[model samples]
Target: MADSVQRAFDLAAEDYDRTRRRLVPGFDDFYRAAIDLIQFPHDSQLKVLDLGAGTGLLAAFIAYSFPQARITMVDISSEMLERARARFELAGERFRFEVSDYGVDPIQEKYDAVVSALSIHHLGDDQKRSLFARIHGALNDGGVFVNAEQCRGATPERHRFHHERWITRVRELGVDDRDLAAALDRMKFDRAATLEDQLQWLREAGFRDIDCAYKNLIFAVYRGIK
Candidate 1:
């Protein structure tokens, strides 16, 4: 699985956006909905942190949506971060990038908002739970944490259905069968937990008002207030 994951994204950074654009038609809308779920005040400025910010997809959207906000993009992969930094270079002083691991890092400062997309599922359940606690500690009072993730469905039948749907969607976009198989193999390592479980974790981490704001099969946006 590790080999497959390394191969799938190792040097495929150049084609990331192209592949996603073709495979995920409603990507922008999903991101928009996640951003809209945040109740940012109009008069006050915000410090927004984007974790596992692969290629800055969410960062760019947040920057555009909340121009007054100071945005920080964090990711464990340097190659992905390079692409993300390059993409948002024109945003000038409003953006910053950091290389960090979410579960292990000690979050020193607080943020008004925390966001992540298509990430976090890589971690096991315990790590995810710990990360939620860390995120709760990283936010100021009444701050928000939003995660758009790939979650496990309620039943194995539903999980299989979502997998088939994902395969169909990717195949429709002309992703090579070899790549698709490789991607699926890597995805098998994903210790994805259910949305209900994640919400419970958030609650245990002391976050309030936890809910899912958007969902498409396994993909959903989970939000909570700190």
Candidate 2:
């Protein structure tokens, strides 16, 4: 499963960043909500980890918002991380990369904040719960976990609504048919849990101040404080 995901992303690496904004209809506020919820001041020199960082788009947002942040980006696709490396080339030692399956690998270090975008939903429900616990353990006392993710709806009808609404919105945004088809194909690996379920899992993982900061169709930004 991991190998298949890696291969799919490797093939898309070149076009990932370009289509990202269009593919995600909620691009503007979805990412902004995640960044704005980070409970830190601008000048704090903090350690941040980005799971499934992809081409480091989310990390780029953080770096711009928080200049003193040092980031570690973990992703299963080397091709994607290669793009991320180029994106952060002049940052010197401020950025680090690890190509590993975050699901099976240990976070291994404490961080001030941990963030992920359009990832994590690839994991099964059990895996999501376990990873939430691991994420909780990997954070400092005041650290926060911000997940800008795709989530399932609370019911079957709602789920269909979410899917249809997304397709409609993206087409309205003028994404070409080929690009839209590819995006839908890659989403086959997604195993999204409902927002309520994920919030409960975060609570079980011993996180506090849990909140769904933003929601737009299937897109959401949820946060938890340790």
Candidate 3:
């Protein structure tokens, strides 16, 4: 399953960023809210970890926002990482890449902040919970974790509305059929949990000051502090 997901992403690596903004409703706010949750100073030389950091989009935003932060980006697809590497080629050692399945890989180093965008939903419920615990352990004191991700609606009615809104908005944004079909295929691997369940899992994992920073239908940005 992991390999399948990796292949899907690797195939889409070249054009993923171009299609993302239109495909995702409230894309700007979702990413902005995630960046806003990172409490470090702009000049702070913080160690940052980006989980499932495809094409390093979110990491690039963080780097632009916090220029001195050193980032380690991990992803399951080397092809995706290659794009990220090229994007940050001038950074030298400021940006590092690792190819591994974050679901089971050991995150050996501690970080002052961990950020993920449009990822994590690929894991099953149990894996999500265990990953949350592992994330907490990987954080330093007062470290923050922010995830900008898709979530299942709380009820059947809400789920229907969510899907409808997504379809309407993406179509309105002029998303081409080819990109839309590919995106839907990738979603087959998603195992998104309800926003409520994820917050509970974060609490169980020992995260304090947990908050849903932003939510728009199925898209949400969550924040937690260790």
Number of the top lDDT candidate: 2
Ranking by TM-score: 2, 3, 1
Q: Candidate 3, residues 3-117: lDDT per residue as tens digits? A: 8899999999999999999998888898999999998888989899999999999999999999999999999999999999999999999999999999998789999999898
How many clashes show up per model? Answer: 0, 0, 0
- The all-Cα superposition gives candidate 1 an RMSD in Å to the true structure of 2.4
* lDDT tens digits by residue: candidate 1, 1-226: 3344434454666766666654553676678778887788644578988988878888877877777988888877778889988997777878888877765788778999999987788888988999999999999999999998989988899988986787787777788866666566657668799998999999999999987878876788989998
TM-score, every prediction: 0.90, 0.99, 0.98
Name the TM-score of candidate 1.
0.90
Best model per TM-score: 2
Model 2 whole-model lDDT (C-alpha atoms): 0.94
Superposed Cα deviation of residue 180, candidate 2 (Å): 0.5
TM-score of 3: 0.98
Pull out the clashing pairs in model 2.
Answer: none
RMSD of each: 2.4, 0.6, 0.8
